[model samples]
Target: MKWGENVKKEIGQKIKELRLAKELTLKDLSEKADLSIGFLSQVERGMASLTVASLEKIAQVLEVDLAFFFTLPQKHEANIMRSYGQEVFSVEESKYFYRLASDLEGKSLEPVLIHLLPNQGREEISPYSHQGEEFVYVLEGILTVFMGDEEYKLNPGDSMHIFSSLPHEWANFTKKLVKVLCVRTPGIFQGDKG
Candidate 1:
């Protein structure tokens, strides 16, 4: 992330150092984390920025808490995420922009507000699997979810819950922008005091 390149480099170093300490090869980590080896390599070299979800997967395979990588805030406050001034993040050129919505200490769920750009689709990308369960509620426009061979078209106020391990991807085919509230079980993000 251009917003935090130095921090990203430090994190990459930490990941590489720990992976070496545990005597795990890149291939080993890749297979265990279900992440592409090339992407992991790029991350370790600080040449790539990954989403919080991907970072969580790496942390799980490395058997370390997120605190090992991030310097979190010391004080804890109300978990409320205000409407304004939220940092929006995207992976590379991804059309989906996300704002971390929940930052409570010791929380069990991580909720993110996703903004899907207009007329964007996930046709070129293959659905991939990850760990945990996810609940997505469409807040505006239409959100399409492709799960394996099944497809679902969700309108405003509609929601879907499914196992994250199922190969799936979210998309928007309309010309209007789409917004969704996504919450994941067995929470993976530790915003403050990580």
Candidate 2:
């Protein structure tokens, strides 16, 4: 799916607004997110797109939900139905596309649809762990889950339940785009410190 420039700009603006509201400078956010100031500046200017992982880091530093970047400021209702045409964002420095499946505030669970690009898997950066549990179902292509020292390969219709505290990561080893439905308890998409 092609991501629109307008959506990228809007998400960037939202992130900038949140940063300003938190009285954080670009350097501060950059340091907190382990990104460079130049990259963060580009992100704020809508000149760059962030991967799901990068956005999660920013949300954590800003103390907001990943959905906050995708959503407009409004009164959130208890129930929400997002259509297929909803915006999808690319991850920073990765070929991943993700859309927030639900944006309800204070929800105990967070669901996301992730499209992992072919031949892309975990980055060389240190693995990250957090306090929660994750459930992933392969919707298309193949997914390789790296949980600490173990690796699990999953095909379409395959699923896995993993403790989020284990330093885990994911990648797509095929030549086609891989799609997965991922849900996390305690909302890993929200203010995660990892």
Candidate 3:
């Protein structure tokens, strides 16, 4: 195969990975990309090529830059996956304040860096039952995490770990913004990347 063929293969693989990460089905993504399902399948399998315009359209529908569909994963160091710089997961602007720094990507652990705005409180949603465990460490400000009938106030450098099957919720109980580092072992991001 030629060098261009190799590049095309890589791009196709990346597209497949991104699509799966976004939990988009062939039908879902084909409609969003404004392309036929057959065409998308061919492109993903590298049996066909796409124009820059088509690629751009697909990337836009996927809510990612075209360049993002080309980034290669780095070699794992001690089974830990790391992403640096402005990496946003599921880029929804509402529902919560502050920014998230990371997400679980094809790894056994989901590590999220969260930022909580002042006076912002996210009610205890429901206990999520998944085949994994959760660990949380406060980076700054004050946070109160409710687990079942128990609520714990967390300060900077405080950490907690529990089975993810327990019901839990969080709220910022301070004037300053709260930052937390949460790692969910065994990856709970099966398809909720959206």
Please report, as a residue range, the 10-residue window in candidate 3 with the lowest summed lDDT. 90-99
In angstroms, give how far residue 16 of model 3 lies from its true place.
23
Per-candidate Cα lDDT values, in order, are 0.73, 0.74, 0.62
List model 2 lDDT by residue over 30-115, tens digit each. 99999999999998898987766677788889987776776433333346644654455554443444546445565777777878
Clashes of each: 1, 4, 1
Write candidate 1's Cα lDDT for 121-154 as tens digits.
4643457666678899999998888999998899
Task: Show where candidate 3 strays beyond 4 Å.
Answer: 1-84, 89-106, 122-127, 192-194
Q: What is the TM-score of each candidate against the true structure?
A: 0.67, 0.71, 0.47
Range of the 10 consecutive residues with the lowest summed lDDT in candidate 1? 185-194
Off by over 4 Å in 1: 1-11, 34-37, 49-56, 65-79, 89-103, 118-132, 173-176, 190-194
Clashing pairs in 2: 50-91, 50-92, 51-91, 51-92
Query: On residues 48-153, what C-alpha lDDT tens digit does candidate 3 reach at each position?
Result: 6664446666777777655465432333445444544434422111112222323335556656676755664354233334345889899888888888888789
Clashing pairs in 3: 127-167
Candidate achieving the largest lDDT: 2
Arrange candidates, best TM-score first: 2, 1, 3
Candidate 3 deviation (Cα RMSD) = 12.6
Angstrom error of the Cα, residue 72, model 2: value is: 7.7
